[model samples]
Target: MPSATHPSPPDKSRAGPEHDLTAAFPTMDLETPSAIPTSGQCLDHLKLLEAFHVLREDVATTDGLYGIHDRFVDDVYPSKGLDEKEAQLLFRLREKRWAIFVANAERRYTIWFQNLPSDRGRMPGQLALAEMSGYFEKTSGIAFDSGINPPLDILMVWHAHLLNPHDFLEDCIRYDKKLL
Candidate 1:
């Protein structure tokens, strides 16, 4: 057999495994995004799991909800603080005193305004579960719809549990008499 000298086997002893892309760069660590999840993403998943666990515990303990005295904050309702312009607008409307008209109408037509968040709050499905139809009727004499238009100074109302006795007493005293 005749021996011929070639390129000396291309120095494959230094080359690493077929899957070793990291071999090119010693400092790099190769791993898929799915293998090691992000902290923020993991936290979100954990929160969801915690919420589910709490719901299950509540259901097991409460036995299908007897009157549902929500201790935790709902953060689903709508509320707003009136601004100067808003106050002026409402004031002007009241000053008209249309009820005093001696022509035909005896009662003043009442128009109730409600500020609801169309997005970033409670979903429409959850609202249905809470039986919000009565709330809608009492507030605006209509039905509650999630797709309602934008509101002025719309904010979400969170119904937190009354953990403190002082807060409970303060709220009771503050709202004791609607009219003084």
Candidate 2:
């Protein structure tokens, strides 16, 4: 979830008559106002990811980016819940966000394997695990920031380590108490 201090992105898809599209994109010429694409007309993957990145940075804990679509909608419409039309729009937005995240993760996973030496042995995986541990130790006291990403190999190892919660916790406690 985004921190209370950070303002939520406007729901431009449902913007009223008073909403000014030109103001949002100052550089663009809006002589023909219809040229301005609404969120429904076209999905901007990069823009959406950038917005998600901002929201991710505001989150203070691990796994904070998970289920962000739901959190964002709930946060924006706290008093009056979404109507049927709004619900459909939100569903589309959530689907796009999920697709973008999965695609990026897949790309990173592929790149991680491509960068590895052809040796294809236990040593490479072990080294990644070790490196992941070191990364955790080095960044133990730092606040969570989505912008600071680990190398894909170390990230893969970290993901695997997280699957075994007990062992991961025990290792963190033993090696870097602050990580816990």
**Candidate 2 regions off by >4 Å?**
1-81, 119-180
RMSD of each: 30.0, 18.1
For model 1, name the residue pairs that clash. 71-161, 73-159, 73-160, 74-159, 75-158
Which residue pairs clash within candidate 2? none
**Ten contiguous residues minimizing lDDT sum, candidate 2:** 55-64
The residue ranges of model 1 lying beyond 4 angstroms of the native Cα positions read: 1-36, 64-180
Best by lDDT: 2
- Candidate 2: how large is its RMSD? 18.1
Q: Model 2, range 1-180, lDDT digits (tens) per residue?
A: 222333334343544544333234444332445756755334333333444443333332222244545555566666564655455545555555545555555564443333333333332333353454454447443222233244433344455557799987775454433223
List, residue by residue over 86-174, the lDDT tens digit for candidate 1: 44433333223221221111110101111222234333223342244454456534444444321111101111212465664564344
